[model samples]
Target: MWERNLNGKDLQFHLSGINNENFIMKDEQTGSWWQQVSGRAIQGPLKGSQLKRFSHDDLTFATWKREHPSTRILEPDPSAQEEYAPADWEAETAELPVVTPRGKSEPLEDRDLVAGVSNQDAARAYLVADLARQGPVNDRLGTTPILVLPFEDGKSVRVFERTAGGQVLEFFAGTGEELGRLVDATTGSTWDFRGTALAGPLSGSQMARMDVLLDYWFDWRTYHPDTDVYRAGL
Candidate 1:
């Protein structure tokens, strides 16, 4: 998600158009168009301006509620209930044709799901299916060591900087009683999906969470042509 406030002005936006399957938001204040993927204003008065990104998690309701028991869900408006997409929207959309002007099919299929990270002049795409099979992954992006954790459910995922207490840590999948948890190589500390060290020397320590965008390969590649594709053991 992106911050609507820019240059000390809170802007209101609405669906302006679609370009290459991405949403283009037009701010009411300046009439500028912003790209959904990059949050960059591409046209009109605020051309070249960027919106500050807000971090979010795309977790399953069960997982989210387990972690945040008191969280309140936003109820859909009753009047707009009929306007909402059906529960099969995703399945239906998968059969639709896609167009990507600046995307490649190599590395992954256009519609493959990917967990993308873009920071510090670097961008990378991690195949979601591979993440489910590989469990927690330890990798570095632009000098920042990171841990990518895929929950047991196989759908939800999270990324965090592995550096904690001034130490770069490596993590592996927990087994048996420790299943669904992460164990760091340095201290054997067990970490929950929240990136918090739950046991061992680093107990109570928290890994810095990083912003991740769960996107399709075509959309990610179209926006980040130079992005690297993560491969197992490579």
Candidate 2:
């Protein structure tokens, strides 16, 4: 997803009515068209401009409430009908038949949620299930030290650069009562899922944020075919 506003003005977008099956959005302000996944304007006055993407987490209402108790949830429109809801859960268990350009299929199921991270030309996808089993993940992307903190439920993740005060640090999964948090090996500081240092010498510090996307395994690999999948041995 991209920022809705641009250049001191809020821009409105609508789906471009194109014969191609690819998803494209057009801004009403400049009449420019954009690719839905990359948020790059490809046609019209705003061509060559890129949209700034912000990080987001998709999680259950209960989990969100526990983390952000004061946050407000927008209520569904009262006029909306039950038919507008999603299809049956059982029907979503299997991957849907998708037709894309030749040689685009990925190795994982289309419905599996993958936590995607990218740096320059290097990109990787960590299966949410594997992260849940392994706890925090300390890895690198193109020489940039990074940390992946997965929620306990395995449905969401938050990524951050593992640098503070110009020093790179390594992190590991917390033990015992500190299970949900991550502890840096160098500083022994514990960080919450949001990358905030909660205790220890570095308390109150925040990690530099990184853009992470949660998408179907197929969608990620389709957009980034060179992506490496995290396996048990990796």
- Which structure among the candidates has the greatest TM-score? 1
For model 2, residues 1-234, the per-residue Cα lDDT tens digits are 689888877989999854233488999889999988788888899998888887666777888898899999988777885646375643564346555444555566666778999989699898887887787788888889888878877767888999886678788878897886788888899888888889988899899888888776767877787898777443
Models, CA RMSD each = 1.7, 2.9
lDDT of 1 by residue, 179-203 (tens): 8788999889999999999999999
Provide TM-scores for the models. 0.94, 0.84
Q: Give me the displacement of residue 158 in model 2, in angstroms.
A: 1.1
* Top-lDDT structure, candidate number: 1
Model 2 — TM-score against the truth? 0.84
Model 1: lDDT equals 0.89
